[model samples]
Target: MRIKKYSFLLLALLAISFKSFSQDTTQYIVANRKNSLAQQNKPYVILISADGFRYDFAKRYNAQNLLRLGSEGISTPYMMPSYPSVTFPNHYAIVSGLYPSHSGLVNNTYYDRARKDKYLMSNKAKVADSSWYGGAPLWVRAEQQNMLSASFYWVASEAAIQGVRPTYYYIYNEKIDMHNRIAAVVNWLKLPPSQRPHLITFYLPQVDHAAHLNGPESPEAEKEVHFVDSAVNELQKVVKTTRLKNVNFVFVSDHGMTKVDNKNPIGIPAAIDTSKFVISGDGILVELYAKNKGDIQATYNELKKEAKDYDVYLKSNVPARLHYGTADDWHNHIGDILLIPRAPKVFNLWNNKKINPGWHGYDPTVVPDMRASFTAWGPAFKKHLVVTPFENVSVFNLISEILGLKHTDKIDGTNQLANKVLIKKASKKK
Candidate 1:
């Protein structure tokens, strides 16, 4: 009997010891997680792109939250998008820090010579194919450095570029409402320290879509501006409620929009046969690919003479300021002759009778309508900082710096431009 009692007592002692060890292990894990989070010192960087948002729209409309962000954070007079200034190229450029020329996404749709394939944005297979996208995107860079990243609806996030994707991403779905998008990001931010993303990208296309359908000055565009602003305000509220630490917000646009007057459309000149050249792009920028390489010069001469409201140039002779054809592989896909229309005018290659009311894709340098907006607010940025106009390419470096991630050496953006908005840490006196 005594032996039986002693055995039970021994078993009970073993159970108590195991329970204590398990508790200790759990506490150790919790402590380590806290320490790990504390050691990370890096801020959560939120990149928000409002497509087709013109720089002047902010001033014209009463975007309360947007204006408040500008007043509280670093605001630039404008951000000049890379040439072509289209959606896909500029969005990719903002993330990759490379010009569209070098990035191999010179236009929204282009032929890949090596692959002998055409890429169209509307084509789901082409859009998701990683081969169509070049240059290391910010998400890939973040993951490579062992940091988690997420994308709500950013371009190229759908593609598994370089066999890497953001730690969490959703395929582009336009049907998803604005509230859901903002809520999804907020939820990601609320994850445990180990699972939360360091970098998050959100895309709001309502303003751009409205701007494209209705002119920038129209009530439709104005309503979208307010809608997007409210969405941003909600995001700020969610973050504030969650009490997230060291979070930064970057607001930008891929490009702007311009009103296209259908009453006076610039039609393709009759002197040049449009059938002979493979035409790509729309609106202000047109790429004419010579069917026969030998006929390139003749084509250029004809285009120059025929085009009244536009300037025509060979790929090699495109203006240095535009930086359109600097890439080595430009000849593979770039048009033999480029056509750019003067501002407030767009090329009408299609003979459709229906009036297209609004458009963009203009030369950003001379066209004020093509300029995009940029604002940065967070712990990392200087308060009420107003910076000189800078190019959108610099955004990549700014994001990399904010996330404490290293960018590839081939990038065109310099750190000097991004430093203008960053808070200067006080130096210790010698």
Candidate 2:
């Protein structure tokens, strides 16, 4: 009887110890997961692009939210866009940290020699095709480092570049109401810590579209400006309700708009033979690809005759300031000769002409209308800071720094150049 009792006691003790050990192990795992979640929830960086919002538009219309952001954080008088100051090229430059030359998106619509394909922004398939895009966008860099990212209509965000995309992305839909877009972004911010995205990008096109239809200074454009401002106000309210910590906000524009009078259209010089080249781009910037490589010199000579009206140059002779021409093994998609019409002088390629009221794609240096808006407000930036005018390419580096992500070395932006706007520079040391 004594032996049996001793055996029973030993069995009971072993069972109790085993149960305690199992409970401890489970608690340890749960604790580790919680810590992991906290780590992943680091600070949030939200990049917003208000297409065609000129630098002066905010001050002109007394945009309350934009003015508040400018006073509270960092604001630049204007952000210079890359050459061919248009939509796709500049937007991609802002995200990829590369010039249009390096990103391979020289124009909104261009012909790719390798695939024998033409890429058009209107063509959804081509827009989503990874091959048409080059360089690492901000979202791609975030995902490669095991960080979460999301986008709501950001340029190039819809494409699965390098076979990877943001954790959450929606297809480009123009009909989606602006309020819905803002609500969706706010919802992403409200996700549980573990599911939250560290980086998010949202695009608002109403301002740009309005500016396109009506001149930038028109009342129609002002209404659209107020519309975007209201959306920003809603975003600010939603963000406060979440009580989220360490969030940064960046607002930018691809390029501004310039008035183009349809009644005063300038026709292409008859000296230039249309049959000798394949032309791409339709507005202020015209790209002419010679049918034969040998004809490049002859094409340049012919176009040079009318040099007073347009700045004409061969690909090799393109101004160094433009920073165009392909990098790496990518084909040179820019035309053999580029014809940039002087501002207020619009290009009318068609023999039959009609009026196009507004346009961009002008030389950013000379034309103030081509300068875009840039404002950043957050814990990462210095309060009431007014920075000198800088190019949009530096924006990519600024965003990467804010998100604490590693950027590809092939980028043209320098961290030092973009760091001028930040409050805590040493925070990015790691």
Candidate 3:
């Protein structure tokens, strides 16, 4: 009788401990998910994003590990960010193969017309609400096909997009140490084949945070760059312990950063009537969401006339290459008028005494400094190959091709990028 009682107490204690562990991890694991037989044998991909890591960061900072790894496989001169060159938008673009305008995450902060709510990156509630997001991210794509995925951190990765989240994901937080973050990914790789994740996304925000706090070229930002570089190297070393033969890595940045003229920031345009138009955006890009449809034309005309240093454009007149105008605004998140500032100058609606010296959110085509970085190294990629610059949207197609996942959703990325970087497969994935 005593033995039975002791065993019951032990079991209860174990259950309580397990629950405690799960809560500590802050991980949300979907129940009863296992990769399909075909998916089980597919190659593994770990997509890493270092926010605000510029195209020249590796070379400029001498990130030896990254330079060496990039050389081991395929890399590009630079990767163009989707229109608006901001964080939330471009990160979603890389995973979803849809430009931010098309995906509804048109900016770091955008006002959704239909719902009449704002999606601010800093608002924890909105950032986690899946309704604010649309594009079928890579993890969502993999989960739909019964291939498990994991995310250390990625925009919208915490949200359940299309009724699915990565099989193993954490509600993004900065508390976890970089070493522990990489360990979690390694642990995912060490899981049993039937339950293991085939797709994983890891994000590092140190570089971006430092760059924003101090100019991108500042010593503080450079130290963070080296930290990220070493972290990537450490992750690769840890991943090898799993001995998973086909593990692949793709390193990229959401957008690049630049030093802006924060001392003499431009105030809200004199022509803008706050009551008539809702203002959104930061630093380099300013958007005007008109309350009344009729007000758009008149307001745009006024802003265009008074515009100095910044160029004003009607949504329709925005350059077609940006894919961000009325025609491309699939969810109507874009404003009727866009105010684009030349580099070194940004808008300050709040009339703040000072703003951060580093900023992005510019048109990459115009401000070459806004180009993001991309490099891929794996058994699947060609070795020591350099390619021309490609749009960030194409990263989605490249990973999709690698995992052999078929995406029925409409996407802006083409298979051309995957073809150029990836090696010809000996046999198609079943």
* Top TM-score model: 3
- State which candidate, 1 or 3, has the greater lDDT: 3
* Candidate 1 lowest-lDDT run of ten: 16-25
Question: What's the candidate order when arranged by decreasing TM-score?
Answer: 3, 2, 1
The collision pairs in model 3 are: none
Which residue runs does candidate 2 get wrong by more than 4 Å? 1-39, 325-330, 350-353, 425-430
TM-score of 2: 0.87
lDDT digits (tens) for residues 1-430 of candidate 3: 0122332232222110001122245777888999988889899999999988999999999999999999989889899999888888999999999999899988877778788776777666777799988779999999988899999888888788988889998876677788889889999999999899999999888888788879889999899999999999999999999999899999999889889888887867778887787776665677778889899888888888898889999888999989989899889899888999888897764445357778888889988889999999988888999999999999999999999888886899999888987888711432
Clashing pairs in 2: none
> Over the full model, what C-alpha lDDT does candidate 2 score relative to the true structure?
0.74
How far residue 19's Cα lies from its native spot in candidate 1, in Å, is: 57
Leading candidate by lDDT? 3
Q: What is the lDDT of candidate 1?
A: 0.74
**Model 1: colliding residue pairs:** none
